[model samples]
Target: MSLPSTFDPSRALSLARETLDIEAQAVAAMALRLDQRFVAALELVLKSRGRVVVMGMGKSGHIGRKIAATLASTGTPAMFVHPAEASHGDLGMITADDVVLGISNSGESEELTAILPLIKRMGVPLLAITGRGDSTLGRHADVVLDASVEKEACPHNLAPTASTTAQLAMGDALAVALLDARGFKADDFARSHPGGSLGRKLLTHVSDVMRSGDAVPRVPREAGLMDLMREISAKGLGMSAIVDADNRVLGIFTDGDLRRLIERTGSSADLRALSARDVMHPNPRTVRAEALAVEAAGLMEASRITSVLVVDELGRLSGALNSNDLMRAKVI
Candidate 1:
């Protein structure tokens, strides 16, 4: 692990690339090994009445934690149980209806094997992820997924490199298979990851966060610029919607227009002599109430505007939204 006085860029890059290629090849091979056993494991987890209890030791344990999380977040009930802890009463987490998934490259982790007999006695189904189907863990499993790899990505072939990668890919395949089987949708995913960016993007609709009702600034088209300015100031949107007699949106008057008009006419009082229709920009960029808030952010950024109107299906103003709304919703 000594640092060289001078680094050789090409040699360093080639070593990294070789390691990646080896692991990639390992994952590619594991895909070919998928068979009926994989399907059986998927069904076993899907049909279980209780949660999926994931168990593993060492490197397999790290992979198990992620697998459990993926399963739980993707509409399946699952959790990771450390095999060592299970031996010391953590087995209480395992219910009779739960399905136990044990992972080990050799399929013979002593901590896991020790509890296999008791789990079987409890009548809970056992699923195994292992490199060797004939290993003790695999033999005892109700269903076995072959997660074998040709060789380790380690240069000396002593590390758990390629094998762990295959295990991860296998776990992903299981999660996705069960996810599709359950017909999980984006809303369901958002419920699990409510605090993440993906959740905000999927679950936060324009109507949910928009400033609606009387809070939206609106004035008749015949209203004077002074009236519009007052509405904008009262509503704090920095803009006012000019609606026709039918309450349909006619145009929008923003602070940008006020700034430009003041610069052109050289006086603030002179600009107020005009009507709303005289100074408003017609056909402002708008979004529907049902659209996602992130879409509103996109519209604002792409058009180089700070605010936009929320309109109904028939072009009636339903609400107002601005860059600030997006920022508050964490959609920015």
Candidate 2:
């Protein structure tokens, strides 16, 4: 479409801002609508023996799908079902043990209304989220959630704008309430979102990514500068663990230590008299082998360093990791 002849940039921005403000106010008003019925709905879903089956039509259907997904990911078992499909045998998916969450802006979606009787017959609890409490769907529902909005963000007040925003907020409110009641934690969320980056950070342990056994660069505490330098260079870890006879880490000699050593000595000959202990940093940061990879990244970032040693229960070096390893694991 070509630009309108009367188009004005200032007017366009003002209209967009007005739409956002209207939607924001609509969502804010929903907080005040939380009543005894809201708690009743929460308790119904909380005590439900089976999954939450969400249903709706049109834009409300889209919002319903999102609500079901959020609830499922946050520890509540939920699935979205099309109201139109429910009349065509999909209604069989609902059991008496399940809870049905129906969404409709006017509380009069015909597709949804078609199956309301069947859902009621199944003895399933129905939670209606609508703008009208006396609406057919609301009156027949076991519990009603008021999602009415004063007005829509639409200039003509025809589109589902503020009403949909209000519904979405209420859906989020329900999911969060269930989340807290279930005592759902980050680890549980990560499990549900296993394909995402957050799952990698939360579930990937340091031991899974760290280089262990011979892969770790180690030199005896009595080892010379040449041996330490060889170990560091061969491992390409920018550092080498200087350990004692018992394989207990005594110190770490890093590239930074090499720089300081060179600056102090001013010649290669000065390095000949130095052993690993003389130039090694005695206080090195360590992480437990079972720690989350993200936690290791946190330590590395906070210390402004690129790597950390992974220690066993005995405080002996078991593995090693650097920023490169974390990057390879996609944990950073």
The local distance difference test score of model 2 is 0.92
Q: Which stretches of candidate 1 lie over 4 Å from their true place?
A: 1-10, 258-273
TM-score of each: 0.89, 0.97
Evaluate residue 273 in candidate 1 and report its C-alpha lDDT on the 0 to 100 scale. 73
Q: Assess each prediction's global lDDT (C-alpha) against the native.
A: 0.91, 0.92
Q: Give the C-alpha miss distance for residue 15 in model 2, angstroms.
A: 1.6
Candidate 1 lDDT, 128-187, residue by residue in tens: 989999999988999998888888978899889888888888989999999999999988
- Alpha carbon lDDT at 27, candidate 1: 85
Scored by TM-score, the top model is 2
Q: What is the C-alpha lDDT profile of model 2 across 90-166, one tens digit per residue?
A: 99899899999999988899999988888888889999999998998998899999999999999999999999998
Q: What is the lDDT of residue 201 in candidate 2?
A: 86
